[model samples]
Target: MEGFQIIRWLSSDDTAAVYEAAGPRGRRLIYTVGHRPAEPAAEFSAWAERLRGVRHPHLAAVAAAGLTDDARPYVLCDTGSTTLAERLVHTPPGVNEVVRTTTAIADALDTAHAAGLRHGTVCPSTVVYAADGTPQLTGFDMCAPALVKTARPGLYTAPEADPGPPADVYALAATAYVALGGTLPYVGDPTDPALRLRGITELPGVPPELTGMLRTALNPDPVSRPSAALLRDALSTVEVPETVTTGALPVAVVGSDVRAVSSGMTTIIEAVTGEQPRIGREKSPPMPPGLAPTRPLPVAPPAPKPVRAKPVTSKPAKASGRRTGRRIGVAVVVLAVIAAGIGGVWLWRDQFAEATEGSSAIERVDFNAIEFTVPADNDRKVTLTGGSATSTNDDGRAESWTLTDGPVFADGNHNGDQDTAAIHLVLEVRGSKRSYVLLFTWDGRPKQAQQVVNGVCDVTDMRSAGPGIELDLVSANPFADCSALGKGDTRAETITVAMRGGFLMETAPHEGATSRCELAPGAETRAQDGDLPVRVAADAGAPELAEDIDSVTVFLPETAGQIQWHLARVTLADGTTTCGWVAAADL
Candidate 1:
């Protein structure tokens, strides 16, 4: 590119080196050069030419093209703002903003495909939000001849066209899906190289209109998907309002920065008060009668009549002194016996209750209304038969059942109680397994309880012998080496718990048994050795597995709240890896 000058190298992938470049007019453009060997470079250049031929306002324009110092073929294109992924973490766009962006990209894809060029890479990283807030499709490294070879992951690829136009359409839809809400259409192995490929071919439930378009675009039969032009036109017609208001924007965005700020604020508050900030507001109930409102002191009534003492005037002083001494001694012995008896009874009662209540509290929870069903290959649904679990009385009894189809629930501030304000029911359902837990105080008690199955209680503060394993997925362990994992990325690592407490891996690349593995963003894996197959995803932190381990030990911090991990399968280009639960005990 004669008009483009490379400022500095930014980053590189297997196929290309991305550089910060400035155009002749000084406009910033990302200059990407294909890795040597000529073939890939030629492919990229031809693809760039094809994209340039099909002009789309939402697509980056190919400014210039040629070789660099190393004779590596390169293309200069407009450098939009950071990727949508970065923006979502720092400042997520409103739902309406997402809709508009998605619609624009869809239109661009439709137009490009109509002209026979497929915008191959359509992940969040490739989609950039321009300074003016428009979403633009930037990368075209994988773009191929529309009628020749399929270029992307099969999950996100279309079955028809050999490498058909519908495949691009599927990618467009997938990209839009993520843009709408930063989650994938299907919840599966994020590390699996095959996931995107599978997503391309499968028709997952998306927005109704988008869903229909994707269905057409992802048609296994090439003839069934809409042409790029037609798809673009269809997307253009999508009636996305200017904005979608999600009640109120959260105080913080949906990523680590917000979390860090919140944590720091909490630490500062706690340092000043010497106590952790309560999750919910605290309110004191009204005081009872006869108690002083300010200090709870009981008022004494006037002294009784003193006139009766006058009649008992004078008796023998010696008789009076002896009688008084004898009475005092007897009273002291009686009081001692009574106190001892009371203490014995209290101790006996406590022991008896402990023995009888063993494992009974978990049984008291009612799981009759809980239903489990698998709707897809790697997704599960847990439905409750009722609207919500309500308890009219503050006795630790099941009053109502709250049914949530997903892992998150809104904390409804009802009863004008601020302490109950942020209490939400968070459910984590993966594959065939189902678990429910109350996210707030149950029955006005400070002791928070989690429901492992339907009625069983897994106290977060203590481990119990329940059906689910009580593994702390977020505890820090200094002994385990987790350096192999990348920073700021989340991935699920499979831990196998064998019958003899010996752990074995079905797949390897973990070079050492004591080595640590970092989870890739959105990475999920499935546990293969457990009685029930569980899906696990790394939501935070790099966890370490010990060498020659049969049972995977997850150390949880005492400060950790409700944490969950779902098993998923990680499939790479070479092979698949499956990891599951160490034991079936609930936490």
Candidate 2:
């Protein structure tokens, strides 16, 4: 209500009302105003401070929190308009959806608990999905505990006076129950203090393993309930039906971007551009830490977000502050402009063809109308009409290539000109997919693009590499079966691809790699001597180490760190050699 253009009331509770509002720049946001709080302004502000301090990918970050003009506490969170509650009304989540949502929220709760703050509230209404399909936990209330209990009792299945971590666990389990097409056992009014969640009702075809885990989490005894971390791990093991996971569900939104309507849910939010609602906008940076909204909003209109000269194609570096929330996703208008500038005019004689070399900034080009020729494959040419192209092979099997993402700008030729853009495409043949990167230059008309590289297994990340493009190529494990690659039996190596002499070339993306313990290549180290372990990758979550390894030989240019995980030639007891990642401490 403070200079924001209110669109409509979304949902409300006894303590506060939530509204869908467009901020000064016409960006949609979730605004909550609390009408009643057991504590005064100072207590509410302190609670908001705690929320601001904790940051996680799965947490719906608080952008602003302070008291309203009428002394009511208000909070503004960056989240998608749709809620889990609204989604359930339209799409009953499949087993995969249930597991993923449960695991993400549980991990989020565990992270919050580790920070010494209790969410104190976890419900369907509080969980939101970002544009990228990442689930986030929101609805951290500033209301006092007693007031929450008297107002929204269904949120907590446990009878604890002060809901803590255990209470959060129980609530997540209950929410999962509802998400898995199982209705809660509430008989009457959900807010009635006398009403209690008796037990979960099992849905037909739902896995007993999942139901059993929820039951354990829904245990009445706070001591008996599984911790959020444990619940997350347990859910990860449950089997999901493949058919259910692959089916599409109707998406709901609160704006004019609705694309389709069905029986249960009215509309789905498809942004003006095809992009989904991003996690955070560059305009809404996190408020300064320790600067609580104690002071009233300025009499004049709030300052508008700074303008950018060009649309950002890569994730920006996170800003530093006490409250560090990641600002992600490029704006819809920027994407729209890129699409309109490129997608709308791909003909050779379009307006972009008239611009001189230094006339103005080069409009970003989309690859939909661009023709790509694979130089190495007998000069095979494939023309993309609308981001996709299909042709029959020699054996009459249909092969297709679709442009998934891109037009990321880089000076591929390194000629001090930003004329080159990298486009990512997916090639599907016989139900198998391979990622390929195409380099195109817009001189006057669309220049002939080259299909530079194809992933032997899969390409994970692609970003600008100064005057080139860097990609993380994952190679499948040689010892494993063909399906093992899909199951993540792979290793990562960063490589840079650049345009040299009008041809794409590959080079080492980065320099200056040194091993921990100051070891050089060919150095020998005894491993597995005393419970030492080796993994598939440098990260801890990589596959667990094999048990038969006897010793390791240091490899050159290991990942740099004080105690880094180094790539080494792992020698097994049988005297065979294979490469793996080992930590410096183990050596």
- Candidate that would win on lDDT: 2
TM-score of 1: 0.37
What C-alpha lDDT values do all the predictions have?
Answer: 0.34, 0.49
For residues 13-46, write the lDDT of model 1, one tens digit per residue: 3454444444433354665555553455566457
Task: Compute each candidate's TM-score over C-alphas.
Answer: 0.37, 0.41
Clashing pairs in 2: none
Candidate 1 deviant stretches above 4 angstroms: 1-5, 24-26, 40-48, 68-71, 144-163, 182-185, 189-207, 240-587
lDDT by residue for model 2 (1-587), tens: 23343333333345554444434322345666654542566876676667678889998776676665555676676654345654554334566887888899999998888877776667665677764668888756533332232323443345565678998898888778766666556534445434454767667667888999998898767899999999989988888774452222222211112111110111122221233332112222222233322122212111111211121111001110110001111010011112112222354423344532322133334457666553223225677877899965445667787887676565443444565566777767666665566555555544543122322354544555445565544444221222333322333334455543332334331111111122322444444542456554444544544446667655433223344555555555543334555656656
Candidate 1 lDDT trough over 10 residues, lowest sum = 307-316
